[model samples]
Target chain A: MKAKILYIEDNEQNLYLVTFILEKHGYEVCAATDGQEGIDMAARILPDLILLDIQLPRMDGYAVARHLRTNPNLATVPIVAVTSYAMAGDRDKALEAGCSGYIEKPINPDTFIQQVEQSLTKQEE
Target chain B: MIACLVKACMPPNITHLMGFFISLIRSASAYPFRNLSLFVVLILLCFEVPPARAEVRTVTVGVYENAPKVFTSETGKPSGIFIDIIEHIAKSERWKLRYVSGTWSEGLDRLAKGEIDLMPDVAYTADREKIFLFHKIPVLTVWSQVYARKGSRIQSILDLNGKRVAALDKTIQLETFTRLTNSFGLKIILVPVPDYKTEFTMIASGKADAGLTNRLYGLMYARKSGLEDTPVMFDPAPFYFAAGKNVSGKLPEIIDRHLSEMKINPQSVYYAAMKRWTSEEVQFKLPLWLQMLGLGLGVALVMSLAGGLILKYQVNARTGELKLINQEMEQRIDERTQALQVTNSKLQVALENLAVAKEHAEAADRMKSAFLATMSHELRTPLNSIIGFTGILLQGLGGAINEEQAKQLKMVKNSANHLLSLISDILDISKIESGQLSVFFESFNLKDSIFKVVQSVRPLAENKGLFLSVEVADDVEEFTGDVRRVEQILLNLLSNAVKFTQKGGVRVKCQRNAGNYVTSVTDSGIGINGKDIGGLFEPFHQIDTGLSRNYEGTGLGLSISKKLVELMDGTLQVDSSPGKGSTFTFTLPNVIDSV
Candidate 1:
């Protein structure tokens, strides 16, 4: 079976970009437009990895990370926070809120797959 | 003489005669012949002496115009100190005093001729002592003084030379004056007056320039007669109750006895008599030492009172001056306090204005930070899509593309990347200026960081056919610093080198020197002018505005690199010459002591 990923993002273009990139890499791409939908989908599908956008509507990525961590079904899954807040301390903030990894916004397509794979491999280890 | 004899001899003779009679009668029976003779003699003596005690002796006391001492009073009765004492004695002695009023000279003459039995106020003199008898105790002490007309210049005996001076006729004062002037060789003419009144009247009328008289009479009448008493005084004498030498009476002796008895007692009639007759100044008649002591005490009291008044005046003056000075000082203090208050108020206003300005600046800084954050998100979100889609297309992930289309798409992707980097540089400088940029420190390899930067720019250098070389000393291998920021600085320097050099080569050198990591990037390219070197590190500064078209750049790379190097406690410096090349070197401390 293909490794499953859930992408939580508010912007449709960011969601499409991440989905296309992950799908082309042979990972099954699942979509959630908001933090709450991402959490529900994460618990139900029990995805192999979660790609989270920090600036989400209604609920943010950090809250979604903490919520997803609380569900036993999704607790072991890796949650990676992708954010446009490239200023100091943003990565630490995302990771402290239960994200397993952090990536800055305007994601470089060249490194995005590698970063996600690193998180999945880290979770498996 | 007969009265004296009777008075002296009668009392004893009578007592002896009676006693002999009784004794003879009792012894007649035993010795008849001798007893008969004694008895007859006793009886005859008793019969011969009449009743002497039964008869009162009459005394004729002479009074005169001499006042206070003996003159008759206004009531027409003989009333004077002399009569007062004499009557007191007369009452006790059972004697009748007969008053014979006369002039002083007449009284003296009467007493001398035995017409008056006693005369009072007689100053004893050798000439009078021949004619009158005086007792041992004196009635009073008197002195003679010269009296002159009120405005006359006769103040002493020397002033009496060639001047007519009047004196009482036959008086001791007159006799003494005559002898005194004559002995001094003064040719003063003499005017004899009958009494003190006449002498004073002659001097007052200017008949004589001055006159000699007893002090008692002068003190009494000189001022009334418009006369001044001169200081020329003489003849201090004792006055007595006097009698004619031939007069047979014990009046002078009796007066002496009474006066002597009165003198011993302070509360006696003698003191009363002196007080009544003499002026108040002479009444108390204190001892000489007592008078001196009283005068001394009086002088001391007056002097102390004067000194106390002066001290009090000076103290008051000083206190007034002190009060004025204190008031002035208080006023100055008040003025100073007011000035300080004004300054304090001004300072408070300035402080308030500064606080308000600070608050406004802080608010504006907060808004700018918010705007930077929002721009980072908004600008990058669309760029994220463009770069992602273009990158996906260039990779032929969706479909195969022709070579020409792929080349054009690569160009578009390159332009998009430049735009993204421009946005990123703008964001970085903004973060630096806003003091929001922070570098993370870790143990990183210096050579690896430089190798990675050189690798990123290697393809660009190969496309331009420029030789790129890197030399990192063996000791410059590992350093504890911000790995990401170090790589960023190296990448900016290498890319700048590759971009500028069209034909020549670029070289990078890293070495450890003085506990610092010194890295230099040197390029051989179209050189920079000396004038442009100074502004090379300023943000958005370009060497040649026309060259900006030929070279696509953000114009912020060198400035960002310089600032980043400075943030790591390092220095960035450059050297260049026209038509030659430029060298940019920076040094970072090998060990960061503090963040």
Candidate 2:
């Protein structure tokens, strides 16, 4: 069975590219425009993994992660943070805020799924 | 002297006196009028009556401050040893002595104007004799001396030239000083003090460099003022009583007779004055250390003890040696400083030369690295993509292609691979030229390395339909070297053998040669010329022939292989002949395993 991933990104072109590359690599991609909607989708569908964005409207990724963690069904989902900013503490902040993994953006279509699948692999183990 | 006179003139001596007068008159009668006139004048002078009863012959004595000889007494009278002599003359000649006081030069002025009848203690020179009539007998023999600060080095009259000297303004030594200056053309400045004491004081206090005065007065004052004596006589002159040049009376002849009488009697006032004034004690300027030793002792005794013998034995030798040692030390310091400067400059030049060589080597390395970097990026980028995409296409990911099309594609891939190797060879040449080539030492399977190179080159051999083979000696498997570079060297030689041999077989042989691994590649092909063999392993050199154009390459294979082998601490060589087969051989050092 194909592993499913939840992608949270505000940029439309970035969302389309990651979705296209994931679909091409035979993985299912579900996405949201910002942090709150991403949390709602993660709770409702409880996708195989959540790919979160750090900067979003009304609620940031950290607050969204808190809101998502309150839903019992989404607790074990591997939350991967996909970020465009390469600030020094961003990776540790994402992991601390309940992300299973971190990916710096301008995402390469080639290694993008391998990184996402690595997070998904952790959930199975 | 008075007793002698009384004895000569008393009645017991009356006939004797008459006898002497008759002889004097007899000589006068024989000489006629001129002799009689001189005899009458002589008799009048010789037999003058006592001034206590007869008409007084008042003689004005001109006096001045000249210390022991002619200065005024503490009682304010014109009295000194010279005055005592004159008083004796007054009592004998029945003349009343009147005293006039002034400086010594002023005494001469007063005498010249006839204001005083007698000026006592004059240093008689021909110049002074023109102004006054000096007595026939001198009262004193005198010379001038210089007194100085204890450390001053004035020992000669010549040493005083251009020096500041002290002198009494009106004294006889001032006259002597002036005469000496004019005679020797000296340019000394004389600082005139009022009395002889201060003349020596000015030198002791450092106000003047030297002082000039009578030796007797200077000696007394030099002790009082802590001054040193130079013992250099300024000049000597006979000191005499002088009479007025205008005087034309019996007074002068009377005074001369009394002086003659007084000199003959030891009991005379003249002899008493000589005993009172003459010291005969002289002192020289002792060196400072000795003078310090004489601080409380009698200066006269110290001077007598220290005059010549003791000083000569001690001072000259020590001073000469000190001066010599000082000169030697100064010369050594100057020589050492000059030598140090020369060596310092030489070291500076050496440092500069090393810096220049280092800069040249560094700049060459930078240029080589920059050229290699650009080639790696710009040239390899397109070639990599072209080769990679071609590989993907031949894998049929897009679609299938016809055999003819695939053959053309295969040719493109082969040519691309060849071009890549040619570029790599050029880059390697630059690296070696700039001394930037690096190699690693490692141990690996030597036979496996050879067989790998053989496998890679076998298809090229098959394309030419040439038999290719390898023989590795039983003991030649594991070795030590930079494995990748060694492999590259083997591949270069194998590729060249396959490319050059068209009809005959190519063979690679590897063996252990007495602890070293030697590899040789032999080929049956159009062989190199014997003359061309020398240049075969130099970069960018190829032999020209009818078949040369048919081959396409940078002609860099054997050269890069040779240099790469050398970089691995090995040697590569070629043996060939025109139209005969050739062999390329190389030897690599082995890591000897311990038992």
Rate residue B53 of model 1 by lDDT. Answer: 43
Whole-model alpha-carbon lDDT for candidate 2: 0.75
TM-score of 1: 0.59
Q: How good is model 2 by TM-score?
A: 0.39
Fnat per predicted structure, each in turn: 0.80, 0.00
- Give residue B395's lDDT in candidate 2 (0 to 100): 49
Q: Please, what are the lDDT tens digits per residue for candidate 2 over residues B55-127?
A: 5568898877767787877889776688888887666555688888877667778899999988877777777
DockQ agreement of candidate 1 with the native complex: 0.50
Give the TM-scores of the predictions, in the order they appear: 0.59, 0.39
Model 1 docking tier (incorrect/acceptable/medium/high): medium
Q: Model 2, stretches more than 4 Å misplaced?
A: A1-125, B1-347, B427-445, B474-483, B526-551, B566-569, B589-595
Candidate 2 recovers a fraction of native contacts equal to 0.00
Look at candidate 2 and give me any clashing residue pairs.
none
Flag clash pairs in model 1.
none
